[model samples]
Target: MASRSDAEAAANAATGRPRVAVFRPDDERLESAVSLLSDLGVEPVPDPMLAVEPTGETPRENADYVVLTSKTGAELAAEAGWEPGASTVCAIGPATSASMEAVGYAVDLVPDEYTSSGLVETLESEADLDGASVEVARSDHGSPVLLDGLSAAGADVHETVLYRLVRPPESGDAVDLAASGDLDAACFTSSLTVEHFFEAATERGTTDAVAVGLDRAVVGAIGEPTRETLTAFGIDADVVASEATFDALARETVAAVDR
Candidate 1:
């Protein structure tokens, strides 16, 4: 009898080309997904399951600090024409910090790790959050980790929900490929994207199919948060990027498939 790994190896040898599904919203990261998979000599399947719409609300005045967790939030908030004034700006990652800087806002701090928990740890140790007013800009679907953490540290946290993430009419081609067991791997960038992907699979009556497909496919997660989300759905990530960046995730995905 052939072992599971042996079967997978035989399948890969038969196909000659690995098919990797890019599971995320259509945004700046899409280009990286396509290009990275191509560079690894894999077939790239673009599966955009979510869309972000900016909210029109402006940032509040008298904030002591401004917190941005994602580049999308930073971009949308900047487009809304809100000034950060003399408030210290904090970004979750370098990408978000760059976005904030591009809009003429000086970033005062960035977490060593690009995560909500990392942000909380950095702020708790470095800044005096007691009774300070902190403004957070992000999507409605964003996790409450940052807000809850800041609030627990005695900061009066205000939220400027800059965008709402909405599901598309249908799961893209990648979901179908995943359901049919035709995909060699799939990369999930965010927890929301992982949630929406399964929801779409259920709606299309491909839940079982996807479950079976995932057993044979290399699952790649962008970070610890996304990997945790995948685990919640009974799927284990075979590869998790060291950094929470698209390029890192793509490289990890290719490495996972190659292994």
Candidate 2:
């Protein structure tokens, strides 16, 4: 009995294209990822692992610094008409900066590295955190490194949950494909996505099988945090994108698959 993954693998092999699993949210981000993979000449398995749930919350108006970690957060803040007011606006990466700019917001600072720790380092060097009010606006699953580091630097930090990242109900197909050894590579953009991938695999009773398959596949993580999460699951990332962006992740993963 040929499994669905077996059939899909045969079709992919016939087409001479590598199958890459992408676990972005089901929005323009996912659509853009799929298009990017197609342009990179790979067959993309568009399994949307994360779904955004807006909390209808905004950042504090009185903070001295406002930090946004993701493009979605920037868009949500703009949608809520949340202005920076007196606060200096900081973005974690170029994409978030671009998103803020798209909404006519001025991005005052962006880290050289695009991680939470990177942002913290940038802020510590660039801003006077002693007794400063900093508001971090992002998703509920945001890393504590930013808040903890800022507080340690003597900044009074507050977090506003702009949205919640929940695993979508229909996100396990890629897990099944990976378990069946149909995937050639996977691009994990966040730590949460890596965690949710295994959650799906565990639910399907294929966690070990999926892990084995992934061990044989070229895996790409968007940043150190995501790579650490994969390591916790006993999976070594074959490629960690030099840039912590999906575009870089997808390009690097596809290039690895080609090699």
Which candidate has the top score in lDDT?
2
The digit string of per-residue lDDT tens for model 2 on 147-189 reads 9999999999999999999998878877987899888999999
Cα lDDT of candidate 1 equals 0.82
**lDDT tens readout by residue for model 1, 1-259:** 1112445545654767888888666766676677788888887777777787777876676699888877777777777777788888899999889888887778999999888889989999999999999998788976789899999999999988878888777554666777878889988989988888898888889988988898799999988889999999889999999988877888888888988
lDDT of each: 0.82, 0.91
Which runs of model 1 end up more than 4 angstroms from their true locations?
1-15
How many clashing residue pairs appear in each of the predictions shown? Answer: 0, 0
Q: Which pairs of residues collide in model 2?
A: none
Candidate 2 has its poorest 10 consecutive residues by lDDT at 1-10
Q: Which candidate is the best by TM-score?
A: 2
Worst 10 residues of 1 by lDDT: 1-10
| Candidate 1 clashes between residue pairs 3 or more apart in a chain or in different chains | none
